[model samples]
Target: MLGVVQTADGLPIHHEVFAGNVAETTTLIPTLTKILKRYPIERVVVVADRGLLSLDNLESLQKMTVGNRPLEFILAVPARRYGEFDTLLEEHHAQHCVGATHEVVGELVWQGQRLIVAHDPEAAATQSESRDKRIEALEQDAERWAGKLVEQETGRSYRGRKLSDAGVTARFYKAVTDAHLGHILKVALNSKDFEYDLDEKALKRARMIDGKLLLVTNMPDYSPEEIVSRYKSLADIERGFRVLKSEIEIDPMFHRLPNRIRAYAMICFLALVLYRVLRMRLKAKNSPYSPNRMLEVVRRIQHHQVTLHRKQSAKGLTTLTPEQKDLFDTVNLPKPSKIAL
Candidate 1:
């Protein structure tokens, strides 16, 4: 359950996964080693969400650092551990600052490089709104369930299932069968109870950090602006994921063997690399064609008729249009021969 993202160019530098278990750290290095063995990646960098905020993981990364230099990392600090980040956020908010990005510099115990912090106001606002919607939806589900619970206790019935007017049976079935629904109700009710203070605090914090986003990176040598920009390059991986999920068919695993799964995935990754190279080339040419459409053109060009005639001398001619010629030139393919008479 971990995804490793590595830069494709030169230096296979990549970041390993966070299995969420300290014991799992041992497995991470080995897993990455296996990938490197087959792929021969150099210059590996690791990036992760806050779920990877583990002292042990940092130590592991430090140990794996090669030749007085360890791997590069872009890791998010947990909100609780974000001491400098919190201060920076407050400073930004206090000034009524809008359309501004903040940067903070620091270091970790295991990492030799200083950590750079970046915050994006607009992205943060969008993310916060999305989170709020999810929380609200969860609360609504819980509230609806709680009302049913009351109905069960009041003697109501559904589809011949005896329930109270408050739907006690309905609530009981829901609580028993759908643990997630039950948990949401528990959380919603507890928000009212004020035992954990989680609900109130969550709502408060969401409002407080309305337009703030935080990202911390160990690439201290680079400017905060550059770090933030590079970190956002992870968006490229989303395109790769779409290709894997939609075109490469990583899911619906037909084989049972683990090796087969790994092999299939690796092959898909290779295909994606080639696809990306072609995509970058097409983009450079400013070709007004989607990758799929470009691929269709390639397929068509491959089958393009090339007639050959044998007489005193052998000769061949190919039928290709000006547009096809332009595409071939852009892709660095040889121009087709003229059609044979």
Candidate 2:
């Protein structure tokens, strides 16, 4: 599923489901086209993560137009491209504060975009600590695996029971592949015997780019701080997805038909829209309660029925706390009242 969330309000504008086998990059254009058509806005600035920031997608976005005005974009560049801005990174680091995110802005005329690169010292410290822990764990596991290989080679009781070279290689690869430590780990295999060691140079290079984020945007008129702020808002889209998958229960769908699946997604999208609206209302009013808390309080307000002489009927509402009343007022909703009918 591909979801295009509006950055202004952090609500889903459109969503589309592709075949499970299709790559997320492949769905970007199609999903975006649907959004442009549905919204019919004169201008838009797309904010997306690195996963959707392919060269082809960037070029296509450069050419796209809405009512003859070119579309703008704020896309995240992957950390793998960190070397491309080494000079800028150094310049920024020179002026970087001890615990602040200092922005180093630059332009690439050939690429037709401005770069807003940020370095956060606190974030770097956190990332470095986490990486060190993971590396330590990886090293310990690699040593254990190497020891097992040695046992298999030296144990006479298991002469024919030793693992094959392929098995040992597979185990080594599996250990390092998804751990993001493959580049730093050197694995050697000889028949059933295996050995692994950390490459310090590679580890140092990886750590150099920690806590650095590169934001590229065609909207150069915006200040670096503005660009960084807009890019950070992309987290709202991620949060919306989490809400759909968790609070809205958009997954584990039992529908079999494509139309039914699409409908289910639409329902979830509507629920998210409503959720955002309520959230905005609360935020605007500076309400202290969260949406969930307010909902819980409202849910406790029940209605009761009373009958007199088997003909007269009256409807009465449960007592509303001051907090509940404040919530209703914040949302511009009327409080439930008793009625005689």
Candidate 3:
């Protein structure tokens, strides 16, 4: 799934699901092209995770530059890709940010454009702590399972219960304890599978790798703070995915035919658009109403029954509260009928 996030404001403007084989370099440019064609947008800055980062991908964006107007991108990088990146950790003095220590690394030309690297210290620290906890938890879990494994494998009566030695359970348990300790150790150490690290060295390296993530961007004008903030804000679209799948019932598509699936998705997207519109309108009125709340209100209004008693002329009337009237007006709908049904 691809998310085209708005940077000036936190809103997901476009989204699409694509085939797995299509590279980001191939998909990203066309996606931006289509968005620009349809929407009156300018100089879009695409942000993506580390999976989208590649020298080729960066050059693709660079080649799109026309007459000094280049596409802006903020993408995460793997620190191991550069030895210079490791040097930054020690020499760079971090500028205090929102709970993160940020150091604005000078612009370096990459793929024909000067790219900025923002290094954050506190994130590395927090990441290190989190990795340590996770590794410790994994070790504890493995040890706990190893004991049960040994008992089952040996078929020894523990506390007087007959344990079957030649059963599926026995085999499974034996595999757990007898499996390569190196694999388990590697996981606990947070090092690559084949890389060797002594216990203390492993712990230290784990802290360094865990606590750090990288964001690389060609947009020189954007400050380090804005890059971090906007890149993280992509989580907003992730939240939208949950709302689309669960709240809006977009997934588990009840259709079998490909065309039918497309139709179903379109309908769900339309519903999402309407819900967004209602939410935006309510927010304009300073209403602390969410999309679901606004939907409930509109549903009641939609189901409102009006009784028309034809007096001298046939006219229409609707039972509408003042609040409903204001809401309807805000949404640019026709005023509730004055003529009673």
Candidate 4:
């Protein structure tokens, strides 16, 4: 599913469900086209993650027009291509950016579009620490595997048949591959002898791009900071998806037909809409309770039947707590009646 969430309000304005096999990158243009046709939007600024911002999708978005006005976008560039922004990173440190946790460097024209580069010191530090830990762990794993290989080579312990040099090398390769440690480690095999070493060159290159991010956009008037902010708002869309799949329990769908699946998705979407409305109301009123807490309070206001004088009385509701009352008032929802048929 592709969701287009509004940055200003964090509401899902549009969504599309593709086949299970369809790639997320391929859905970007089609989803945007559907949204444009459905809404009377004169100008648009699309914000998306790196996975949805391929070169083809970027070109397509550039050429899109709404009533002769071109569409705008703030798309994140993949961090793997960090070398292209070396000059920008150097220039960013010299600039004075007050009250900002990140530094936005000037824009450059790339592939006929403006590219904005930003650096976050905190993010860089966190990423560097994480990478260092992974490298250390991989080194330890390499040492353990080397010891096992030695045991196999020597006549210390044997389980049935002994492993060949190729077998030992293959086993080590599989282990590192499973752990995703192949990038930082190199393995060598020489006829009954094997060795594993850290790939220092790759680790050094990764460190350079630790805290840097690149953003591509077609908006000429938007500053680098604004572009970065807009792109960061893409997280709102991701949060909406989480709400659908987790909070709303939209997954593990048992529907067998395509139409049924689509209907279920729509139901989840509507539930998200209602949830956001209540959330916004509570937030506007400065309420300190979360949606789940409010729901729990509401759930506590249950009803039960009573019998009186050989006659069955209507259901009677429990009294609401002060917190529940405050929540209802903040959300502008009327309290339930004490009794109901």
Best by TM-score: 4
Candidate 3 per-residue lDDT over residues 169-194, each given as its tens digit: 33333443454223224432232221
TM-score of each: 0.62, 0.81, 0.65, 0.85
TM-score leaderboard ranking? 4, 2, 3, 1
User: In candidate 3, what residue range of length 10 has the lowest lDDT sum?
Assistant: 188-197
Q: Tens-digit lDDT track for model 1 on 1-341?
A: 33445463311223333333545445666765566566644666665656665677766666675335666776665655544445545554545444456432222232344444444566666766776666566555546655665676677754765433234334433542443323123332323221111345445444545543345556657666666566566656656667768876667768667667666656766777667676777787898876677666656653344345653433444456676677878867677665443
The reply for model 3, stretches above 4 Å from the true place, is 1-25, 36-41, 66-68, 78-87, 90-130, 138-184, 187-199, 209-213, 256-258, 302-323, 329-332
For every model shown, the clashing-pair count is 27, 0, 7, 0
| TM-score between model 1 and native | 0.62
lDDT head-to-head 1 vs 4, winner? 4
Local error of candidate 4 at residue 190 (angstroms): 8.5
Query: Model 2 over residues 133-201: C-alpha lDDT tens digits?
Result: 988887776666567666666863344656655776777777787777787887775544466768987
Tens digits of per-residue lDDT, candidate 4, 225-327, equal: 8888887877777787788888899878898888888888888888888888888888898888878788888888888887778795767788888878888
- For model 3 the TM-score comes to 0.65
Cα error, candidate 2, residue 50 (Å): 1.0
What lDDT does the true structure give each of the candidates? Answer: 0.55, 0.74, 0.58, 0.74
Between prediction 1 and prediction 4, which has the larger TM-score?
4
